[model samples]
Target: MKIKDLFKNKEVTLSFEVFPPKTDDGYEAVEKAAARIAELKPDFMSVTYGAGGGTSKNTGNIAADLQDKYGVPVLAHLTCVSSTRDLVREVVKSYREKGIENIMALRGDIPKEGRIAFDYNHATELIYDIKSLDESFCIGGACYPEGHVECERQSEDIIHLKEKVDAGCDFLTTQMFFDNSTLYQFLYRIREKGIEVPVVPGIMPITNKRQVARSVALSGSTIPQKMKIMVDRFADDPEKLKEAGIIYASDQIIDLISNGVSHIHVYSMNKPDIAEGIMRNLSTIIR
Candidate 1:
């Protein structure tokens, strides 16, 4: 099923994201984790592309298995940076053969060695390539609620976002955000720019102390004062921090739904425990 269709319903949609393991030896454990999350029966699940397509085959394999074995619709991510256009075509073709209908197109993180022979500089170019290969595929793009870390201004970010939507992006999902207000303001600003595609807010459940700085550094999502207080208070206790983090994310989802943002995607971080906790908390609200 196309993720775009999932949003057409009156009730809210809740989705989860899982990533393939980096190495072959790690695949089995990740597969088991994905299976456990699938048991929650989310509206859909997305499999992330590995850096530089290092785990592309595993991405396709796991995504196919999710749909085939667990009865979940899969959105396989495809990153264009660090790859040639031919590689993108080849990956898309494999995804189609594996019964994958949705893709989250990303520009991806530049390698530590820096940009080297990248065929596409931006995600918009990748979006165009995906559409040109197969118009039937539902292509989703990423947006930043607090503006992209690289882009200096939010206004410029929105303009670039509009360009992606115009290029045939089926929907947009935000980078993980800690504060709901940031997303609310971004939604207003983007709509004013005339980019009206369905925008699903991405929520990351911060289960441990390490994820805190890494997430902030990557997305530049402002951590609210209350959230910081929670982390500071519970950071030492692993179990307590996990519980608090889940509740915090659940609150964010409930608030989004209350404000009429029906579609919410959780960056599950390949942990079924976190996904299950959030789903259990949202049982009555999402259903």
Candidate 2:
């Protein structure tokens, strides 16, 4: 199923994001994790690419397996950070040939060891390139609700976003955010600038105490004090912390759905229990 179709239904849609393993030794375990998440029947699943080609083939294969063998729609992620124009073209061709129809175009983070390999600096450039290659693809781009940490200014960030939409991005998915008010505020700002595309909210469950700092540094997202207190209260007890994290994520999803934000995605982190537990908790509300 094309993600655009899923977005058109406008019902509360839930999806999962996973990455392919880097080596054969971990392949079976990764596939099992993918299968376990697939069993939950998320609206769709996304498999991420690597800065290295070792995982590039796995990205395509896992996407094909989930979509063809498991009877679920899959989106393969492609990045320009470490790929040339022809290389990216081949990856897009591979996905199309495999019957995968959706793609997440990104200018992925360059490796810490060196500079970017591609000419493109932003995801919008990749979106345009992908559009030229296959007009059939339902391309998705990433948005930062709190402004891209690297960009420095939110207004400057939206200007680039406008360019992306103009370049033919079908939809936009936000980088994971914690507070509902942050998203609501972002929506208001984006609408003010005429960015009316469906911005699917990304939610990450706080499964560990250390995760707070790790997430903040990775996505440059802020963790609210209230959530910090929750984590601190349950910090010493692993079981309690995990439970609290799930509830926090559930509460975040519930609030989004209640506020008429129909499209929601969970960064499941390839953990079957986290994904299943979240789905089970939201079953009644989602139904």
Candidate 3:
């Protein structure tokens, strides 16, 4: 099913994301994890693409499995920054053959080695390419609630977002955010700017103390003082930290849904326990 259709449903929507493994040896374990999460029966599940081709091949395989074997609709992520046009086409064509219709198009992170030469400089270019190749595709794009780390200003970031939408993005999934107010403000700004596509907020359940620092460094999502205090208090207790993290993420989702944000996506980290905890918390609310 197209994600846009899922977004249109009256009941709030929830989805989970899982990534392909970096090496072949770990493939079975990751697939097992994906299966466990699928058992939670989220509105849909997304398979993440790796940075390079080696791991990326597994993306299609996993997405296909989720859709065909597990009977869940899949959103297959496609990254274009480090790939040539031909390579991008090949990946998209492979996905189409798998009967996967939804795609999360991304510019992807530049590798540390920094291969400067590229056929696609931005996600908008890739969105345009995907649409040109197959108009039937339901393409989703990524957005930053607190502004992109690379962009100096939130206003500039929204402008780029509008450009991406104009390039044929069907909807957007936000980068994970800790504070709800930041996303609320971003929604107001984007709506005021005339970019009205449905934006699904991404939530990450921080189960580890080290994750707090790493998440901020990666996505620039501000860690609220409340969350900070909780982390500080429970950082030493792994079980406590994990329980608190799941509750915190559930609270974030409840608030978003109460305020009429209908769709949410969780970066499940391929952890079925976290996904199940969140789903159990929302059992009455989402259905």
Candidate 4:
């Protein structure tokens, strides 16, 4: 099932994201994570491509395995930061051959220690090229609800997002945000600017206190004070903290659905427990 069709109905849908493992020893574990997530029966599952498109092969493998063996629709991430034109073509064709039809096109971050090379900079160009190569693919693009970190302003970021939508992007997924108000404001901003494509709200529950710091540093998204108090209370006990974090994420997701944002994606970070906990909490609501 292409994600575009899934979102077209604008039905309440839940999805999970996973990533490929870097080492052979980690492969089994990561693959197991994918399998466990599949058991939860999300509408679809997405596997992440590593920085500079390094894990693309593994991404394809995992996605194909889930779709082929488990009958789950798999979305593969294809980053273009370091891939040449030929590489992009080959990757898309490989996905087609594997019978995978959905893709999350991305402009991955440049690696710090190695030489960076690529034929594209923004994800929009990659979106254009992918559409040209495979018209049937349901292309997904990333949107920053708080505005892109590198953008001059939110207005500028929406302008760039308009380009991607105009380039045949089927849907857009936002960067993870803790506060519902930020996303609601961003929705207003984008719709006002004529970029009204379906936006899947990306939710990241602060499962770990450490993730909160890193997530803010990476995306510059604000951490709300209410969540800060929750974290501060349970930050010491591992079990209590995990439970608190899952509940926090559940609340955010529930609020999103209540506001009629039907499509939601979890930045699960390959944690089945975290993802499962959130799903467990939402089972009644999502039902």
**TM-scores vs. true structure, each candidate:** 0.98, 0.97, 0.98, 0.96
Over the stretch 170-277, how does candidate 2's per-residue lDDT look in tens digits? Answer: 788899899999999999998899888888888999889889999999999999998999998999998899888999999999999999997888999888889998
Q: Tens digits of per-residue lDDT for model 3 on 1-287?
A: 99888787646889999999999999999999999999888889999998765677899999999999989999999998888899989999999999999999999998889865489889999999999999999999999998898999989999999999999988999999988988999999999999989999999999899999999989888999999999999999999999999999999999999999979899999999999999999978988
Tens digits of per-residue lDDT for model 4, 1-287: 88888777647899999999986568889989888988898888999998767677899999999898778888899998888899999999999999999999998876677546758888889999999897999989999988887887888889889998999888889998888999999999899988877899988878677977898888888898998998899888878989998998888898999999978899888899988998899977776
lDDT for model 4, please: 0.88
- Give the per-residue lDDT of model 1 (tens digit) for 1-287: 88888778646988999999999999999999999999999999999998778899999999999999989988999998888988899999999999899999999988888876569999999998988898999999999998998899889999999999999998999999888888899999999999989999999999898999999888888888998999999989999999999999999999999999989999998899999999989989988
Better of 3 and 4 by lDDT: 3
Please give the distance, in angstroms, between residue 253's alpha carbon in candidate 2 and its true position after superposition. Answer: 0.4
lDDT of each: 0.92, 0.88, 0.92, 0.88
Q: RMSD to the native, candidate 3?
A: 0.9
Looking at candidate 4, the ten consecutive residues that score lowest on lDDT are 109-118
Per-candidate alpha-carbon RMSD to the true structure:
0.9, 1.2, 0.9, 1.3
Model 3 off-target regions past 4 Å?
Answer: none
